[model samples]
Target: MNPAEPLPRAGYADVRIIAASPDIARRVADVLRRCFDSTEQRSYPAGHDGGTRLQLTVDTAHPAGPARSWLAASQPQRADRPQGSEA
Candidate 1:
């Protein structure tokens, strides 16, 4: 699913990301925070030697319009960073 799209205004949604490394996982979580009104529900080392795992929850019942707007505005700045730089 497109991360930029707004979530439904009902129930709850969960997102899980497994990054190549802990740093990438953290960066992804930060970017997700900018795009959604979500809470960092859990974070832990993945089993089977996988990278860090991050889980986030979005309560669609809550307002998220402002966060979406901010995400749109910040995309340009985020894109300008060097490919491997920290988020």
Candidate 2:
């Protein structure tokens, strides 16, 4: 994914993982959290056989533009003042 490309500002992205064991599923979830800043939305048993299922949701937001533009837009500039005096 290109960093400069505009991303979807709304809706949730679902990520599902199936692992041989609960511990492995949890480990995968941990990696997803670190990579995408997401959290586990839910978890369950995979089926009659032994395994685990994990789901994670990533909430989308509009990208803030380049750093310099964001900073300029967010900060208010002070008015120029006379050299000698405080108002």
What are the TM-scores, per candidate, against the unseen true structure? Answer: 0.52, 0.51
- In model 1, the Cα lDDT at residue 1 comes to 68
RMSD of 2: 10.9
Error of 1 at 73 (Å): 15
Instruction: Give per-residue lDDT, candidate 1, residue 12.
Output: 68
What is the per-residue lDDT of model 1 for residues 32-66, given as tens digits with 9 covering 90 to 100? Answer: 67656687558888877777888888764453567
Candidate 2 structure quality by residue, lDDT tens digits, 1-87:
468855544554667789889889888777656545465458898988898988777543322334336646777766785455665
Note the Cα lDDT for every prediction shown. 0.71, 0.66
How many clashes in each structure? 0, 0
Cα miss at 36, model 1 (Å)?
Answer: 1.2
| Highest TM-score scorer | 1
